[model samples]
Target: MAGGLLRWPVVLCLLNTLIISPVRSTVWTAGSAAMTQGTAVVVGAAAVSSTDEHFVCATLDWWPPEKCDYGTCAWGLASLLNLNLSSHILLNAIKAFSPLKIRLGGSLQDKVIYETEYPQEPCRPFVKNSSEMFGFTEGCLPLSRWDQLNEFFRESGATIIFGLNALNGRVPLSDGSLGGPWDYTNAASLIRYTVNKGYRISGWELGNELSGSGVGARINADQYAEDLMNLDRVVDQTYKGYQFKPLVIGPGGFFDANWFNEFIVKAKSSLDVISHHIYNLGPGVDQNLVEKILNPSYLDGEASTFSNLRDILKSTGASTSAWVGEAGGAYNSGRHLVTNAFVFSFWYLDQLGMSSLYDTKTYCRQSLIGGNYGLLNTTTFKPNPDYYSALLWHRLMGPKVLSTKFNGTKMIRAYAHCARDSKGITLLLLNLDRNSTAQVVVDPGTAQLSAVKYHRGGVKEIKMGEEITREEYHLTAMDGNLHSQTVLLNGKILDLDAQGGIPVLESVKVDALQPINVAALSIVFAHMPSFYAPACV
Candidate 1:
């Protein structure tokens, strides 16, 4: 028995067998072995499947940023801080009172920037007359709703951006052909009500996507300028306490540079933010095509459009910051698989990184939840792949940007974040490639890792209820092919993969060389465990 205990017979053997055999079999199984002892033969075994499939690592970057709140948020004062979910409308109606600041708004304007979302949903077909529209309006929150939403924003550490109804609620089209002599009363009332309720409205957009009217109401640039200018005057005079007139936003979609330039020149000093939208997919495109569209470089194209606008704004001396108020997947519902899949993590991370370079201060995703673009799923209120991705970014990325570089031939992208917390710095890596893997470097510091966590999935289409497959998992961060073989730790290659993950040397100095990898179609975040200060890296 003593001899048997001494010779444990390699309790667990690592087998690289394809476990996708009989569908009924589980991927992991238990195994046993018999060891010959001096007195007797003892049988012992262990249950082991490949547990090293998902890989993630983090290193401390000497530079860190000020701690700030960052994460996936919704549109307008109401959504930024609160979820409107409720079994009863009246009960949920309380959401309007708690308002959050820094919301993303303007669906009507989305059309002008994207040349879409212009055609308004024909008022509920069931509404036979004004009474029904009133009933529907009662069920829904209108301009008055902003009062409560703004309160929530203030209490929750956020601000408000109210999307006005430039398309409906004012002009009655005998044939519904975009008729409005202009009703500053309701619009003016909205601005006054916000002030009366003591809610600070950071910006008040004229109309959402009025440039093309694809989904809402299409109006010429000149016409939009007129409406915006008129509304600007009323809001400015009525809310003098605001110090500045609410920011007027326009051209919500389609990258309308011509319209943006024209509006800037004609409506000088009137509009604060030149809003825009973008969607990256061709309808009915194949999976391969979708994967190609999810590339980080694609962001470069989107950024270029903003760059052109930024240059124009600088030339015109416009003071308003560029705000991506409304944007998400191609369809109202997200991409069939791409957006909902882990692939979105790469896209989102790049967005945060690029926003600073392009001088964009604020970026509002389409929805917090609801529509495919929402950060949370409407039905489950559970975080989606994007939600988890947002959570990591919010928790790690701080107020200031840090310097880091990425050199790669394939698609696994990387970004580094430094903050003044004991958790050390975090390196974010995304394996955008649906099939191939890629490796990364993680610089180690004095703090050794206390723990590690990773999120991975198969292909880009693995939907709800499906388990990620072993092949897919392994392919995500497969050693040499998908990751860099020589991961330098404090300047030396450490055999960390023997256990699988980025290594953290205990009691190491602040600047340590760390190597990490991003598995295909996965998001990897590394958290350092120890004690330190909070600052911008």
Candidate 2:
């Protein structure tokens, strides 16, 4: 009897282990529950007009180059000494996104004086001791240097939107405002020089932050309008024989409703693009950088500015399209790890998605290589996390914007586009959820299903019969620190080679029939190479 009892217990234990042990892996299924409670992302075939092709652009600061020490430059000691305009690494990276647009303007731009002759000696770098904002000693961009810059841009397929000095030699008015019948002799000479040399410039932006409620010294709207007219005359006169004339854009300042309305009205039709700058998240020193970026509500707040500007342009009957000419989330050179890190993508990518919806024609990121916010590391000239994010966006997202609906928590934000040069759709899914993982199933909607069968809209119950393949390019931090600059794509770290060459993008194949498992606190770009949406083609 005792031997029989022992054998029975052993047998029961084995059965219990077989029945209760966890499965080797858990494949989270997507169903009505996922649609109802988790996240249901539906992408429609209806197409918005082709978005601005040059939507992703970058800027170059006016600060003269200096020695780099651990990615941080001594702003005070910095002179235009170390900037290799044709650095192999820099040009190679820029060429990756060929036909790139780079704006050569910043705070120090207003202080610059264009010297027709090359300086006998390089300008001595000096720091100004002043309480005023952006108070830096004068720097000169010699004609010889400008030629070198033009050659660099031409070779790299970059178009330049050069900012001319508006505050240089301006007369301070009785009202304590900077009044300008601004001096354009130097500027005009430079324009003539550029046109004479046959350098292809896309635009000539007049001033930086001198528009409405200007930086430190305000410029009246009426005065700025006159200045633009002067610059316009110069451009027209200089490019008379040329086939293409560069665009004239200006008033690149923070959007103040009163200031922007007045400037647009005064500038009239002279402006080619209505430009504005936004650093919505305030200064970089704020301690809540992580929280602010992760919060969707904070990210959504920037939309109001976009809407207001568009409305103003429409109300004024201006033909100019709106451009977020300069935006770098937090000002004051940006936070070290926060701006340069992978977490910044949540903010950067969201801006790209949100701005397109509001009809923003072009968005230029501040400081392509100077400040801490640069897409590339200042010292090493290595592509930062945001660089890869921008590259993936440039490679995958097309000009046509598609409508996407996410019926779930705001944690999962989604944007869709027709894949560039391909007969398919691309979806950018950002899982901002701090804890819960999201399983996303792409519903191609009625248009995609009907086209699959009869090559047109007909059946309501049409299904994708075969397994559809998808390529997912995920951008996530290896260890989970949001501020870490180390980014992993499809489970591999992207590092430069011995020759400073960037690695080719790798993707993991996923079946469209299955749910896409989006890990928490990550960004996934799913490319459907098969679903040929009409808008995409």
Candidate 3:
């Protein structure tokens, strides 16, 4: 037995012995219960809709300016720090999933003041404050800095959705309405400068969390709608003869039923996309982070907001679609290891699958870098577990979302999509069960199953004929440490190559007829090359 173990790779051997040991006996029946009563999931070929590229978007915040001094700041930190947009590693990571959308705004966005004169000192530090939203007083983005940012966006192949300040020296009236017209002078100047410099921004979003009663300050729906129209006029006038007009998106804030309904109804066709933010699990300090992420009911609860927004748009006769402009599992930074670790993939991927079902055109993550929930680490810029998950979703899952039905417990969630630029379907299987392993049988409608099954004890023989090809990329942590940022694909850790290039994704090929053993607390992305899903083509 010891000699036989040496035949396989060290990683595979370790995985078999340490991680997924004690193989359980269970038959996963695909189609009708007559074949076997085991757990099963059927993936349908019918396409729901063309997948939205903006579905996988991220953010570049404008807070805690990267190069701060003591009590003052310049060149908002995210522009100078967090994103090394020019780095080979960063660029390569981004290019791996090209055509990425990045939202450049945050709480400090409303506080930012763009200066045409180049600052003598680019960045200064401000007094450290306990409140996450209070340190923007020192924030300034000079023209030179903006130039650098635009160039970086161009090189990174990113579409910029910039947020303009809404509360710049504005006040509320006696009845708590916007006292005067929004002070768009500072914002307009910056937009005009960006256009003059030939920056290709894709969309212009106004305000940050100023939609519903507001965050720090409130803006009535009527006033906010007027502000949106004013911004629309600014866009039309500024780029009158430009070849491509940027999309006008607005009132970036949380969703309140009445507030959203009124804004959409009043804004009418002025807004291009309805944008909103979500932090479903509350704060990062919550000790029940793991429990919350693993619960299907808890995850599905966010769907109501999406459905409501869609209904609102339809009822209001607005042409815009919904976009989750910003969403992190938790607010105020994030739990150190929980948000960045392999376990976070459960929440992140499920959100992607759920959002796509509700016709959400785009879903931008809270951040690409900075904060504990970033896809990449803030200091080292190393790809977190969620980073690899995002890459795989981009590479394998196509724009066409397909329907899936699983007969097992809700602990094992399933989502299907047409394989990107391929002739088959990709199934994303997430096993959130922390204790017991689950088995799944993929049903390719009406086709006869034929394949060989290899197990630890011996090979389980099955009818064989035409090749039934299947490939899987399983993500899990080493040493059973759910908090560890390190991720293993298949049975190997994904690390940088000797030359610092991104590691290639390792996929394990299997027969479609065999039952797939989904280990506890793991994610499995399966690609079936045989079943030709018409939507993919």
Task: Assess each prediction's global lDDT (C-alpha) against the native.
Answer: 0.43, 0.73, 0.73
Residue 344's lDDT within candidate 3 is: 92
Colliding pairs, model 2: 65-80
Query: Count of backbone clashes for each model?
Result: 64, 1, 14
Off by over 4 Å in 3: 1-45, 65-86, 117-133, 174-179, 444-464, 532-534
| Candidate 1 weakest lDDT stretch, 10 residues | 55-64
lDDT of 1 by residue, 167-205 (tens): 533454454335554455555655666677677666776
Q: Which ten residues in a row have the lowest lDDT in candidate 2?
A: 1-10
Best by lDDT: 2
TM-score of 2: 0.86
Task: Report the C-alpha lDDT of model 2 over 336-446, residue by residue, as the tens digit.
Answer: 898888899999999988887777888899767766688888777888889999889888988888877776678888888888777577888888877766766566665
lDDT-superior candidate, 2 or 3: 2
After superposing candidate 1 on the true structure, give the runs of residues whose Cα lies further than 4 Å from its correct spot.
1-155, 168-182, 212-216, 242-246, 282-289, 293-300, 336-338, 402-405, 416-427, 435-437, 442-511, 525-537
Best by TM-score: 2
Q: Candidate 3, residues 1-537: lDDT per residue as tens digits?
A: 000111121111322353332222222211211221224343343676444764688888865653343332322334432345656766666666787888888777777777754445554433345564454454677676678777777787988899888877577678654546688877888888888878999999988998776776678888788889888989999999988999889788999989989888888878898789988988878899999999999998998987888788777778887888998888777677898898899999999888787778888887788777888777666789998998898888887887666776788888888788776778888888777566676654432223322222112222223334577787878666789999988767888776557799978766554566567788888887665444455
For TM-score, candidate 1 versus 2, the one ahead is 2
Per-model TM-score, in order, reads: 0.58, 0.86, 0.84
C-alpha RMSD by candidate, in order: 17.8, 8.9, 8.1
